[model samples]
Target: MVPRPTSLLAWLLSTLAAIVLIGAGLPGPAAAAATTTGVKFVDIPGDGVTLKANVVAPAAAGSYPAVVFPSSWGLNDVEYIAQATSMAAAGYVVVSYTPRGWWASGGEIDTAGPADMADLSKVLDWTLANTPADPARLGTAGVSYGAGISLLGAAFDKRIRAVAMLSGWTDLNYSLYSDQTRHLQSAGLLGLAAQLVGHPSAELTTMLGDFTANRNIATVMEWAKVRSPATYLDRINANAPAVMIANAWGDTFFPPNQLADFYGKLTTPKRLELRPGDHAIAELTGILGLPNDVWTSVRGWFDRYLKSDANGTQPGKVYLKPDNAAAETWSSWGAQTTSTKRYGLGAIRWYDGTGLLGGSPTTGWSKSLPNDLDTVANGGVVLLTNGISAFTGLRPTIWLPFVDRNRAGVWAAERPSTALKVRGIPKVHLNLTGTAANGSLVAYLYDLDSLGNAALLTHAPATWLSGTAGSRTLDVSLSAVNYDVPAGHSLTLVVDTVDPLYYDANSAGTITVAGGSYLDLPVK
Candidate 1:
């Protein structure tokens, strides 16, 4: 069973307290030159609130291209001090501010809702009026919450010319409720963080209440739609801001799949970079003014669009960096895949309780597994697992031999003669018959070595809760990834009922998997 809000909150607080040392020596706004010759912190009037902000302008500045950065969730104006200083030193007028109700800022937290969007416009207005900021060459950039607001600002405020949305979500609905399953850990962490460091509005409070209780979901999605940039894609395209999106493949809060979809629909000059990391991990070093690829590309993006520089990252390209491999670029998202192969799932062998995954299907068989129980195959703990993987170039691993077959259905393919460069999203098709009215499945794709050690490549979840029991056909697209399976390595698939990362809808029953299920692989 999923933990109640109180239990989740307690867990979150304890986890944060234990990991607080991770941030002990990190730079803060005090370490930044807030009162430097060309830098100053000030208070600006928001729509109906007061915003704490810092402005960094070129010391020998005429009017210059300006970039406004709204602080990330649970952060204040100093969140972007290093990035702002670097951008300012490079001849851009940069203003970074805390959004309403975060830290020293007044008003309740808007969660990047309408009021937050209004604050962004107000910050821009203040920038142009008070500093040597050129109104015509305006741009916005941020990470996480700031990134979402920046993207929405580009759609609502036409004066913005370019945007770099790092680790941002294009669709809020998908983030909170993907595959009709609540992302319990991610949502709980966000809600708890807001309550710890900021004031939550009534709307945000109610949204969390309905979200956790699994009630009024349609209304919650409606509210989310209004904040999603995907909902305003037409307006964004019409305004034509050069949009550059950089996200980690393992971003729990704002996954890369939605960013890829949003990037595909963009008619304006756009770039997408998918790397191996969790939410904001890929760009965290850049926040400390260290050398980072995402921030480098961010500066390059603004230079090209706002300053009309000739030497910037070329638009209309997608960059994918695989773990422990060289970065690869493509003309577009579609070009990431050359062809796809469908692997039919066969009957489970009685001796090992495992099935064969091959080119041809084997029907007339069924396998039953107890629901509401997790196996060795599960998505790792939300942030820490993926963040460690990003830095160490390793994924959460499992010994395939130890997997509990009674709790999960396992399938393995034959070893290929050559390496398989898996590039795009993997699709799973399954026919599930559940004894209970509600059930869920977490599907995992793994690369298994000769010794039976398996590394997670990608995974996704699907849930059925329409008060209908019996058979249901589920088509699930696993998270997009770029992984290479070495020659002589086999691909493994595992389907289990519960993962701690998501809310499990499964109850006390057995879910039977029918034969005719298959997995689709997109390989380059």
Candidate 2:
């Protein structure tokens, strides 16, 4: 497990000091054409405390539809004023509220625990009880934190006619821990953010301690499972609400793979949009002087599902814009296996002491790759950008050199015969053995251009919870991706042990890649 910060002061400083778009300015009426609206404060019977909420009604409204907005993590209900007001103007009895524990709301922070979930149910119930909300036309939408609860609400409460989520995680385990490797920075930052915005409940404080200390994953996972909507997806699908999912492919907090997993399982009237941006782009864009394309599309989604009015047209049925910042849409999310491109790992020495990543797919060779202790000892953040690169403008592609030439194995495809669009998850076939008691294997897939500037596609790691301690052959699936490796650009696959993002074996072991070692990609 990645070690957590030891000092309370360090944790406090990080959370309080680090705020993303807390005060980022939202644009003028152009982004929010929802018109001036009437607003009322509402107090409700929460699980064990009083819940504060807002009811923003369209200026000229009579039993209009209703839409509920939940604040993102660490934010109050008012944080979504622009969104609520805009929806209200569009004829929705817009209801928005802070979760308990934040912005002077009652109760302690549970991180979407039982209390939080119950609070959401009661909030919606109270909204209908007090406001002139059309119970049949109720809808919900939010980003990141709010996006998740909206899904949860729809899953348990069928009264929600429509639901839309952006940058929300479907599975907490997948988002927080992968291959037994805890996403340390993200997990830690989340706890700190919660602390900064809302003081912890006694239970939450204890959970935070276990998390920060890397004490035990079992405890953390159990708590996460209760709050994960994917756990209840089957139920959600059975009595599902009209769903719209806008997942940022590059969001580190909510991996696209998990989002796709949720989208695939939803058996309801649904739409999907996959864009490339970090965690907050869908919500923070309007605040940063950028056109609020995403929010505008969201309004149309509610207009259709909540009001039974298409209002002209909606965003794409299924939007996909991966790398290169270009977008395309389809009817639904499905596995697209374009032709296969295979790159074989060989024994040839390419860079420094590293084995070559470049060769014909037919090449078969056994090569001994050592473990890079120094790189394991001192590996920095893999990239400068936190999650996905921005969608607009031309940005520099990432160039990755071997951390330790001899210890890390580098394999590249012989430059593509033509420029090919590579999409979907790449599979790695490996035959390997351990020289020590136990070991781990890490593989990173990258797109290397003619001049050797490389950009990360996706990576997967495997570790032994407990092992045979000797020779083992394995096939590992890297993270699912929709990246395009252009013409003249070759595919680079790096294999080694240990990554800073994951728990490192920190053990010195040699795992030789036997014959039939190759990287298989989906090429279009």
Candidate 3:
């Protein structure tokens, strides 16, 4: 039997009381039997301060499985209420708490340090002792920073039986300083904001300074080397099943390829779910302004693994949303959605006096002329060259939005053949050259099949090229798709410096290119 609020007012009051108690530090039972439901607070020992958490458990009196969610920039207890409520209603215990130095919790927050993992372990032990939670049925889940903590917890805590990580980063060093450019949108701005709000530590401020100045990757890599999860990958408990979910199409924060690399390295019974969306979990649900679908998925996964409940559970399932056709419709893996095809590069082409030959040896490529936002608000310029013949069969179109700019190019390719249906993600590789020592790069996939067609693929952050870069190869994996690239239709890769939707471009650098660049299209 699940616990129910006595009444609407009671539930509201209980929630208010919980909030007040968290803020004021007064020690009274902030909840009643009816509205209090199953939530409680427990204290854990920290290095220099005491750590506390707001825990929600199944209403029934029997021992239940538990899942832990660590704190992020805001109040973890409140941010995870939806998940807590859902998991509790589904008869599981959910623990949401602040990390060492955030809000009500005491001690300093060291981002993703060893101290945080130890704190998480202490919380796990506290939960098992104080509640009717089965110690053998523990799991963890979170998103972004919280997800990072969850990964760390699972790596150190053998008691955790499973984990669901959303948009979690694997190598912090690579994420912050890939290609010697700090990602202004994600690691730069968002990370700075989190530090300011959560810890306000001088160390965090200095770190933010290094990121803002576009310092070399080595500096950022040094910080990441001390805090990355890569060093602890082998420590992940093998008994626990892990589900790594990320948006291959996310343009704001992590690079999609890096996430894929992390997913591939997991030693546990792991799975990867790549979707089309930004970092927000709501995109997975298609419910604008509502709770994220990941919450439901988490509950279901916990129910299946922690409680051994077989209802509505399946393993190794991969879903890809159709591109440009319809929103909210997903196709199962192995379903043919795109026609397999390839596009050739090396064909001599010209764009505004820039002659494209087989290699960079063909000179005359210049930096992209800056266009006002209005000129290329939606997409980049489509260069029409006469030297190259029109493509035949299923082909991909390539377009460069930013010229002579570092980290602001969009590469688009034509859609695949209608007959060859595509079920998985589309991959594009390009051999690029630049005159500058450092720059950023991004790739996008567009669906031209629908009215007001939108981009179908946006990848996580990846290394573009840097350091007196000559010709460098860039491989981008887009979000999973099951759609038809109709006959006569084309898939375009928008190559640019930065995704306007996510980050701003480098206003202070010059990036020039030679004509030997070629985009290799692998459609499956």
TM-score of each: 0.95, 0.87, 0.72
Highest TM-score scorer:
1
How many residue pairs in model 3 have overlapping backbones?
A: 43
Kindly indicate the candidate among 1 and 2 with the higher lDDT: 1
List the global CA lDDT of all models. Answer: 0.86, 0.68, 0.52
What is the descending TM-score order?
1, 2, 3
Residue 156, candidate 2: C-alpha displacement in angstroms: 1.1
Superposed model 2: Cα runs more than 4 Å off: 1-35, 38-42, 211-215, 287-290, 311-316, 350-388, 391-402, 435-438
- On lDDT, who's better, 1 or 3? 1
| Model 1 lDDT tens row, 1-524 | 75645565556445543333243224434423443235688999999999999888877748899999987887766777777877777788899898998878999988888999899999999999998888899999988989999999999999999999999999999999888888988898888878888889999999999998989999999999999999999999999999999999999888688888889899999999999989888987777667889999999999999888989888988999997568999998879799999999999999998899887666898888897777888888777789899988998899999889988899999999999899899999998765478888889999999999999999998887879777888888999989999899999999988888899788887989888899999999
Tens-digit lDDT track of model 3 for 1-524:
11121243233334433542354332223332333255567666655568767777766578888888875444455556555655676677778877877766887667777778888888788888877789888888776667788877777778888887776777786666554444443443354345544564565656767756645546656766666666677777354555545443332455445565565566665555654444533232321113455555666677778878787334555434433334332233333333545443323234532222212223344335222222122222111110011111111222323223232333333434553344555665555554344444555554444342433333332344445546566555553444555654444444445543233333344444334344433344
Measured by TM-score, how close is model 1 to the native structure? 0.95
Candidate 1: worst 10 consecutive residues by lDDT?
Answer: 16-25
Top candidate on lDDT is: 1
